[model samples]
Target: MKGIILTSHGTYASGLYQTVKMIAGDFPNIKIVEFHEGDNLENFDQKLIEAYNDLTYKDIVVITDLAGGTPFNRSVMSLADKGNVAFLSGANFAMVYQALSSEIEDLSEFVADVLEKGKSSITKFDMEEDDEESLEDGI
Candidate 1:
């Protein structure tokens, strides 16, 4: 089995999780750890450890908001020894949605697809660059 762990500097993790739940409903395999203001690194690390321990999946993926931020750094340092776990930073709705919705078996393939879809979802809609005559035309 595979699972997802979402951690961020503040409520971003929980907020994003809630948004995903609204669209995709609840998924039992997903866990969220939030690092709020005034929270110490030790506490946050402990909470992350608990979250990881709670998951029964053999393979886990930890997603964080920023690459060099506390959440990401802590996860890497703490879980680096875990062979079946992977880490991804700068997570967005598209990445999480693809992760929770997909039924893929291979962890590498799953992560690759999530990265591809997530990156592709980011687009700039410039009227001038896109050669759109008017905003109303796009609508």
Candidate 2:
């Protein structure tokens, strides 16, 4: 089985996990490491280590809130040389949901698919314009 770790600078990690649970119910092999205001590198390191150690899966995927932020950096350094670990930064709800629900055995392919899903999920909505246009079209 593959595991997932959601890390973020604030409560985003926990919040994202809660949202996922609300939609998909509880799932094992999924964990969250939240970095609070007073947390430093060592704190993040410890949290990551604990989360990694608690997982029963051989292959693990870590999703961070920002690409170059502390959480992402710490995860990268902590998982370095760990062949079974993969990192995916700039995480979102779609990515988390897809990852938890995914049955893909190939770690690389699973990460790629999740990244694509995350990228495609981001959209710019102009609701007023869209509604006006639709009304004008008599649809």
Candidate 3:
């Protein structure tokens, strides 16, 4: 089984974890680390190391909220040397949800698919003229 580690500044990691749990129930191979305000950098990095060490899965993916932030940079420095680990930034519900819930045979393919689907999930919507008119007419 593959493991997933989510880290973000503030409560974003915990918030995303809760959202994932609400949607997909609890998962055994997923962990989250939140870099709260006033948190020491060394301590946060230690927490990340603990999280990484705790997961005994064959493969792991560390997902962060931002690319160049502390969480991402620290995670890379800490876990990049470990083999079979992937890193992703700008995390969203769609990607994390899929990554935690999926059971694909190929980790690379799974990550690629999840990334693609997550990107595709970003969409724009514009109400049509008829719908606007109906709303205006109280239909």
Candidate 4:
């Protein structure tokens, strides 16, 4: 089994978790850590430790809202020596979904797949008018 940890500033982690749950139902070994206003690095460390300890999976994937932010930096430091852990920044629903649902045994491969999926999922939606205009122009 694998696990997922979502960490972010403010409520992004929690909100993203809820959205994932709404779409995919409750999953095992999934956790969220929110870094609220006035929260210190120690606070984030504690929360992350708690979440990491609670997971039953050997391979854990941690997703953060921003790269080089407090949550992301602390997570990187905390899991630095942990070979079973992988870190991903700029988390979104698609990445979370893929992480939770994937049954891939290889941690590196799984992380790579999720990263590719996450990146590919992001796109600009064109309005109908613009789409039609582009189609008419043979785009």
lDDT of 4 by residue, 1-139 (tens): 5888899999998899898888779888799898888888887888888898899897989999999999999998887677788999989999888999999899988999999989999988678546655656631
Q: For model 2, give the 10-residue run with minimal summed lDDT.
A: 130-139
**Cα-lDDT of candidate 3:** 0.86
Model 2 over residues 1-139: C-alpha lDDT tens digits?
A: 5799999988998998898888778889888998888887787898898898898887999999998898888999988667899999988989998888889999889999999999999987688656656656631
In model 1, which runs have C-alpha deviations exceeding 4 angstroms?
127-139
TM-score per candidate, in order? 0.87, 0.87, 0.87, 0.88
Tens digits of per-residue lDDT for model 3 on 2-42? 79999998999889889888867888988889888799989
lDDT of each residue in 1-139, candidate 1, tens digit only: 4689999987898999998888778989899998888898898888888888999987899999999998999998888788888899889999988887778889999889888988998988876677655555731
Which residue pairs in candidate 4 collide?
none
Choose the strongest candidate by TM-score.
Answer: 4
